[model samples]
Target: MTTKSLSIPLDFPFPSPKAHPLLTLHSKIQFPCKFPLFSLPQRIQFLRNQCPPKCQNPNDNNNPVPYTSQQEAHFTETQEAISQFLQEFGISAAESNSIALNSPKYAKMLFDSVKDLEEWTSWKSGGDGNEFATLGFKEKVAYMAKEKGDNGKVAFLESLGLSLSSSMNVARYLHGESLPNLIHKVKYMKEILFSDSDDKRLVGKYARCMMMNLSIPIDEDLQQTLSLFEKVEARRGGLDMLGSSEVTFRCLVESFPRILLLPLDLHLKPMVEFLDSVGVPKEHMREIFLLFPPVIICDITGINRKVQALKKVWAFDKDFGKMLLKYPWILSTAIQKNYKEIVSFFHMEKVDKSSVDTAIRSWPHILGCSTSKLEVMVEQLAKLGIRNKKLGQVISKSPQLLLRKPQEFLQVVLFLEDLGFDRETVGQVASRCPEIFAASIEKTLKKKIEFLDRIGVSKDHLPRVIKKYPELLVSDVNRTILPRMKYLKDVGLSKKDIAFMVRRFSPLLGYSIEEVLRPKYEFLVNTMKKPVEDVVGYPRYFSYSLEKKIMPRFWVLKGRNIECSLKDMLAKNDEEFAADFMGF
Candidate 1:
């Protein structure tokens, strides 16, 4: 579609009516005219003297004043000015007062006749048919007829075929009517002045006049008033007017708070169109727009209908629609504030894991702000035995939840770890749960073995140590065996042998062998190397036989000079050799 640009001047002035002749005369005449019964010629002369230079038509003086055209033009201008003034205040004339008055036919005729006479005099006098019309003789007649009673007022209004409410006078007296009422009054006056006149030009004049007169007390009312202009444009089929209305709406909505709450639909198509034309922020409008629900469902059964309607209206923006699905609170301020209650009211189905995950993923920061809530949620997952890493990732990513109460978080993490969690998982959980590392585990079998290695216990000996010291498994090997191992080399066994024996026998003996061996190394060494002959108590027999066998070798060796051979080894093997070797 081709777009038409409307350039509404920022300072368009309302058209003002020409001054009334009677008012001019009254201003000039200091004292009331006592000569009320003047001749027709005298009255003419009197009017001519008071009239402005433009109204002195010498050629037309003899004829009755052709005041119709002049009065119509003057009234039109004055009405235009009034409408413009009202529009400036953000008031609309149309929606405010659309009803015509109720009265008898004769009364309507009399009223119309009186109105025609007023118009004629206004033109002849070259005066503006405006608030100053009260000075005209025709106006006096209309006022007299109006005061005749309710019947008279109804008749006058009916002649104009306009709706007139009795409450209007009361409303004026009260001064309590809202902006909408003032707009209606201006609109009614404009309609009367420009009824069915094919001059499309006057519409702008009237629109501008209405725009000028408009005023709203609150931002919200101002928005509604501006929106009404858009409606006027749509009805009048004027794109320029619509564009102007849209520009005004944009300015008002931007400046005012809660103005976007005005309903915009088929009834307000022009407003919606204007908003679109001006590129108003859609997201910002979502909450305000939804505030006016076309149909409210009071029961669950009506949900389908509500959803369908909402979908149709919001279908263009999926994100907005989705927001509504999850957060209907966006529809109203009251609802948004009490959103939790609303959620509970609907007995909303439990959010699925995927939904919860999406929410957490979407706003990870919220988890920290709502740690207790999140923890409860996570606990539910735990109860479900969902050991998925994604849960851990969620917790880890939301560091706030972990850091909120470090001690509590750590405790939870440790508890999870104790349930057989792997280190990587535990560490990640711990990062999110800071309380676990607060205290160190006391030394025990497992801790001791770990401590032994920590103190430089060789890896090869670790298993052996564990095996021999079954009882030491419960002892603090780090404090006991570690201190005693240094004493092994001082006792006769080599450090390497001591280390090997401790590793091998520690577990079997169920106590740290290093602890047991440090005090008994000498006795242990003696026991380990004892000969088979000594153990069997046959040392004397073996010694005699060995001497008989080696005596010849010794004699042979002495003569051959092969000294320190078989004879020397046999000499060492004897009891005297053992006694000397031991230094006994």
Candidate 2:
């Protein structure tokens, strides 16, 4: 559809109102009251002296009459001047404010307005609107995006599932980005404005922040850089991030605006590909980018050196990929300044060299921290009655323990005290499972306790249950614990039996029903012809690998006419089972 064009008309005429009776020039020129006619310039000056535009004449006495020849000449000259001014600018008298024509500012405004109109007319005559300029900002953007062959980006923005106002707001926002062709750049930036999926106000906020922060006429090479960033986001589920109800994506750009200016192929691509090669899963790339956007932008040699230090120098035997996924900010830490001292400190503290990566994976933020800060954290843990080798074990198990400030740690201690645990018990619990320190005691821990209490574990028994299975305090009641217990109940275990099972085998809550319970129980009920009581009595049956150990032994025992129970088949190690049960 053809859009209407906007333009200024060249032939727009000024309208003239009815002239003053005495000021009107008749066919025969005659002066009123037989006054002698002055020269034209003098006549104009006499008219100005009679009545200025904004004020009354000072020459007149308090009582004034209209028919004096001087007044008549003055009024006539003033009318001629008004008529000439309107004809000069071609402005209609009806449209023109009489007060406006008398001021110097109005003359300047007329000059500028006329100049702009002339230029616009000339351009229109030569180039006609071409349909582009006539389009609204949004349609213009879509046309430009399509012209650049960026249908994917157009589709990407359209798929945001936003309202019409929100979509137009985004279009307007991206147009204001000052991109040469906004289509390519808009894809990378979609997340920043729409981070809160349903909030339209952020669109305005994002524009303001960009106008304040980003230098403009954005550099040309930055487009390619931003394109690479968009490729990364696209790979990492940009829509899902944009769909987030929280400010996850907005926080990413705010934290790392420099990511858009880095060299993509030379620096960013290689670094990201290197991380991917080494085991950084695509899922975790967003986290890595948000946390350490410089991972790709920093000196490639430096990033490589830091990575090598972790892999070769520190000897991270645990899966480096999983470690990177866990501790993405570790990539931002300096290799030369921080890597050695931190590794050595952990090593000196009795954390095994290979397990250093595991420790780092658990609490990646420690790699960014100072050795002295870590040492202080250790000393604080020591004051809590967890010192020396015990403190090292805690750090190794839960590296995030080092990240907690001294006061936050004290709060956890105080919170645990309120929960009826003594200092010694807290120390013991922390030593065994340092991850408990990371759990939200008020929410996660409290909910777990409430769930346990609802399920028949008494207040007196709470400490014992938690001490035995501390992970239960942080486990999702709906996702893990309840689902597994519901499966047990569906199979005929009563609530009392299930509660007894939880007390007897609290670790069973950690195993998956799909992977562990169903297969083992199927074997016990269907294969062994055993009752549900067998599984209830021995919950350890769920922990064994079905193919590797459990099934192989069960079939061999059945072939040999041996009546081996689930515990007997799984309890023995290879050599012990061969010697004792298999007749080796």
- Which candidate should be chosen as best, given TM-score against the real structure? 2
Can you give the lDDT of residue 132 in candidate 2?
37
Instruction: Let me know the TM-score candidate 2 reaches against the reference structure.
Output: 0.49
**Which regions of candidate 2 are displaced past 4 Å?**
1-311, 314-336, 383-392, 414-425, 527-530, 534-584
Provide backbone clash counts, one per model.
Answer: 44, 5
Writing each residue's lDDT as its tens digit, candidate 1 over 1-584 gives 11122232234221111221222332332221121344534533333332323344434546544445454443333223323332333544431112111122222233333454455545654433333344443334334233333322232222232222322222233233334433343343233222333443433443443344222122343344345445445544542332232222322222322322222232233433332433433332222232222212122234335444534433333344444423332333222223233223213323333433344333322321322444454453344332345444444344234223444544544544454554455544333322222223342323655655654456565533433333343444446555455454444445455444545344322333444433233222352232222212221212223235434444444455543422243536556544543344
Give the Å shift of residue 322 in candidate 2: 7.2
lDDT of 2 by residue, 392-418 (tens): 677778877776777777777787787
* Poorest 10 consecutive residues by lDDT, candidate 1: 95-104
Q: Which predicted model would earn the best lDDT?
A: 2
Task: Report lDDT (Cα) of residue 257, candidate 1.
Answer: 20
